[model samples]
Target: MLFFFFYLFFFKLSAQTNLKGKIYFDNEPKSNVTVYLNNTTTGTITNKNGEFNLEVKNGVYQLIISHIGFQTIKYNFDTSTYTKPLVFSLLEEEFVLDEVIINGKENNDEWEYSFSVFFREFIGTSEFSKFCTIQNPDVLFFEFDSENNILTAEAIEPLHIKNEALGYDIFYDLKHFSIEKKFTKYLGYSYFKELKGNKNKQKKWRKNRLKAYNGSQVHFYKSIIKNSSKKEGFVINQFVRKKNNDRPSQEELSKARKELSKSNVALNFSRKIDKPKNSIDSALVILKKAKLPKYIDYLYKSEIASSDIIHKENNQTYLQFDNNLRITYLREKEEKGYILRNPFSKPRKAFLQASNIIPLAEKFIIYPKGILANPLDVLYEEYWSYEKFAHSLPLDYEPNNDD
Candidate 1:
């Protein structure tokens, strides 16, 4: 029998609406405030007068305004309703000691465990994470609520992260990070600055960047826009899971019990316990297989589906689907060859799932210029979810054309 190990693997802007804004703290103009659209590099620091302007296309964006001493603020801005320069008033943050002493000796273990968990989730588990280091881990404060089963983390200062894999120095202003039983979520603003490298290092970085881009969400979106998803090794299949209403009746159970009794009788009469034991094992296997389909109905099977790409006017593309979508990116021939030599190797095939059945609103959207922006836009449930900051690239990063 061939043992098949199924493994799950895992934006841009355009055009001409000016978003002018002023940031204030306690009714005083706050200069040097970093203002930017979340998940994109399009941003600017406030001038001496606390004024800044950004030109963006008509779309929905999460605007982040952050300063050193005050609390960071995020606002959802729609360009359609934006008319004039926006004014933001940020309040000062008050630091107070907790009376309950949550960080006592009893909770030290819990805190350490939570920190480890946070590091793994936030930095990721990929090879990239091996080279990524958090310079100011001491700035993070962790809390756990046993009643809610939530692990929360906050940072007093911007996290200094040095990524040797992608060659970037990142300053991340983490607002919140939480891990519940089923979900892990975090919200933060990051500023990525490229590291200076020699010619050979630059070449290596470009090669690595292209490797990261392939089989990524950005690559998938671009392939969809170009109507070349299949050509790009992407397989879109409809995932169907049906409710199994056919359960074993009482009569069936009684019959099964009677058969077992008969087998026992045969074993005693023949005075051969070993043969009957094998018979009983075979019978159990058959019975288990018979009832398996009913109890294990959640196992999804893929069905053939038509193309999901929909091209609209003005260069807009949509991946329209009703039920859940199972996307698979097949490995290249070279990658498969490498895997053949090493059976324990990680599979190059990448899988991701996007469902409309999520409890929250749909997070994915396709922009007019074929740029897909929004962290919440797609809930990557499989191997892609394992990709965190270590696998992340800047918004302005473009893969090398030669690749």
Candidate 2:
């Protein structure tokens, strides 16, 4: 019996041979598809040119083929000594729901945070579509202030937008918002002090420079905005900075330095509207009704600042009763702040800010229009995913939901 077993082992070892093959889609080569012998836990991916080489034994086995957007396929084949080279034709699955139309062209393009409107300049585009759909009323608030010669602003409301898909809510308590052209110290480079350490190293670098002011920005938490399809509150803060590092001559810097030190520096606040809707219009009405700030440039240039919620407390206590015992719980939430310099404020001391807020709604509401309901159907379709089970597209891309 032991001799027979040894013979069988030798035969099996000699029978095993390498299986090589090329995978294609109808006559066209395909790449990145997984191919392997089924039920063996062994597989290999086709190279960039859709070529693959695998090893198999001299026996009948099942072949498996799979790709992200294609259906998995299986086929039975034998690895006999006389069998010729093998070839496979893979077919891609037609995901109709994943299809999108943008000006009659539907190509896969990853969504990014920046967008360009014509030749105006590249700017930060809203990531609302990236936020997961919320079934609750959540609001994100922000403010743009440029009253002082320093031209800094604060966020007076929440940083995360709750139920953002429904609408947006913002509260501004500032009056007379304006963007004024003034020379201000560039504090953004303050980090260099810690980074470089040596005081002389700091002096070797330009401490302050003049920038032709463009605009500013306040960071928004994309994650909070995503889960905020319901009852959510968040905040965003904005900041002002010189547009280009276009250094102002020493003389110009000296002249602006005097103006920067003024107390209660006389400045202007401008209210402008971009893509104004009923909600934004309503917010403007409130701003006007409150006699807050003067309206300056509409679709013009201005300086604005926004702050983020760095710390928060629920200020509430919850009690739970279990049989004869009671449990009370308290929690604390931590937030972070980010600073952004307006990339557009140069060669022109102009900027613009449009303010508005949308009211909350009940149930799963799609506001104004349901243009972005699919989440995957937005202008940038590459950043979204859909689950066969959920029947809804979410920004979350887990391996289980891939293709």
Candidate 3:
């Protein structure tokens, strides 16, 4: 069951590498250790002798080594440079005795509320999400900060999630998860297993998988790397957005709000005090204005090619640009959810699958098959941010002729 049916996963691989490895704990062979490449179906569990083997195409991948009681190890490897018969020693997971979750008891009502928020933000709110289920949701612990209204969650182990829509069972090794009013952030590595189904179900899943992949970030990444954006029905536009000089920075606004609420919220910890009506009204005005956008976004009508913003230096392909990168996948129409959430006032704006990409760093090193060296180096918005586990497909997934 640990095997990924190598031939099936790497059927299209032009050049493949045979990878072999062993796991050890406290100087002894460790069995049943899970090893896999993140975001790909190239995975296998350790055998009785602690040995594992897998085949991968020539590419860079993050090799994940995980066990129930052992500390997880993420080893970055390249098929070209990494050789065979690799050995690893996993350390025991250290338990922190003092770290107790008190929020569940303090805010019992918020437990359901927090899980709802986590499910929406983490699993997503697309049509595919209805078919995704978290099998080990009970293992998740939560912490809610009443003052700041932030929700934090941690899982005792990898989350067992089944995506019936995609016919995949996913084990997600969650590292960080936190949600607040303005932002949500979670980081995890996932290993996928194919779910058996009837021919009809498999065919339907294939169609859905292709639909998810077509206008996705992965598809766009692949197109850019191959310099085939136009051929792939993608329109690239340079987005130049400027900060609103008329508005104060978020940090400044937050400080002002906190200072204004000092007599109101901070003083509540010790005793109850009445907030001055005029001061409270003034704070309300600033708080309402803070909810407005902070940037002035300029839409560019002149479209550009992927090659215009990407460069190759020393054989390493990277994306660098002055502002955000707006992408519109012309092959498919906008997901109904997006269209409903953001209705187009002008008929010209009724385009399919539009997303804005903002770079977190000055440059991002990209690879073939729509992967990035540091995936979090760029941020996504609009349609790109809408899809999650429910719409995910294995990197090796290929469409059948009908799909």
Candidate 4:
């Protein structure tokens, strides 16, 4: 039995594609450097000679390599098309942390408030956020611009977070983070490592992970890829959103109201309307009804099939469409945080998670695991906008109900 197990392990290793690379810093071998494929568990540490061997499935991947005090290297390539070994030279990065230290302490009140804001916007406020702890928040630096009402943050080193809810340890190479006017924008590369636990604990984690997976973006993408979105309890509608030209602009309405307000205490009565209905009310009616909505959206009543938006070219899957896609996952109800943040109430029969997908380009490639080739090529609005890392699974997560 032991011999069979050994054979299986070697067989599996032999089947995987290997990425070989070496790292150097200041013309010297950089040992113990962390090298990994972004967002995946495939990773390795550099040997004393600064060499690494990473194994993964045959696909294109975003590679990351780094060590503290050294500038990180990120490379994207296709494993199936590349045959040459990778060589990287990392540069030194300076750290000036005194200002951040003094800012955290000297202004204790502001620091506390800033930290709270960062915590809510960065790590997020989902149910899983309570179980996710940043192991090294000290490496973070915060700056708030009072005039712009924006908060920006940077980190000297990778941020390590342990997620108890998902049974994973996550390392985020944070590139940028900002929050302004209740909107948050952050960009980063991440690597995930599975946490070890006993059988019972593992069972519970599997349940939790499966729960988080259902109705997620990846799930929706996967269903579309399989052409089973409707069967999987997802309804899609195509809509065109346009400006409501019938509604007057705010400036026009304001100017009209101002002109009426200046009307010498009673001259508004001359503004003819039948029965002399309260001068102010008559003027307001003439000023364009304030109840007119600012935008009008025409939604198609028919549900679209996955094939309408998903296409394959040159053996690669692509998602393309006109206007926007209104997706509703009926299997899962909307998150409580999503409901509280949005203006919509849960309709009696429409208790579902709703999101809108807008393409920033003509179309974007969809990789095998439901990951977008360029995440920024499209915009995710509504419920998707509210979801952060606390509610996410790594791109490489292979789902299984029995996990």
**Residue 224 of model 4, lDDT score:** 94
Any idea what lDDT model 4 has? 0.75
lDDT tens string, model 3, 1-403? 0000100111123588899999998888999999998777779999999999998887666789999877889887777777658999999887542233554734667667778877887888788898999998777778777799777788878999899888899998888787667566777778889889999998888888888888888788788878888998899988788877657667767865776767544322233334535554445445555756688888775578778878999987888887788888888876666556545433343457788888879997776656666766777777777776577776776655436
List candidate 1 stretches off by more than 4 Å.
1-12, 16-20, 53-60, 76-86, 94-109, 242-306, 309-318, 331-364, 368-378, 400-403
Model 2's TM-score against the true structure: 0.21
**TM-score, prediction 4:** 0.82
Clash pairs for candidate 3: none
The predicted structure with the larger TM-score, 1 or 2, is 1
The segments of candidate 4 whose C-alpha lies over 4 angstroms from its true place after superposition are 1-15, 82-84, 95-106, 181-183, 245-248, 253-293, 342-350, 401-403
Candidates in order have lDDT scores of 0.62, 0.29, 0.75, 0.75
Instruction: Write down the TM-score of every candidate.
Output: 0.67, 0.21, 0.81, 0.82
Compute the lDDT of residue 321 as modeled in candidate 1. Answer: 54
Cα displacement (Å) at residue 65, model 4:
0.2
RMSD of each: 8.3, 25.9, 7.8, 8.1
- Give the distance in Å from residue 220's predicted Cα in candidate 2 to where it truly belongs: 59
For candidate 1, list the clashing residue pairs, or say none.
363-377, 364-377
Error of 1 at 378 (Å): 5.1
Please give the distance, in angstroms, between residue 209's alpha carbon in candidate 4 and its true position after superposition.
1.2
Residue-by-residue lDDT tens digits, candidate 1, 1-403: 0010111100235556889999887788889988877655567899988899987666667687877667778788777778889999987766542533246214767657776888877886666788899998777777767799877787777888988887878878886687877577777777677779998877777777776666666676677776777887767665545654455555665665567677744433323333334656544433443454553224254532334444364554445554455667674222322234337656666323222212123334465333444444445554456456676775556676525
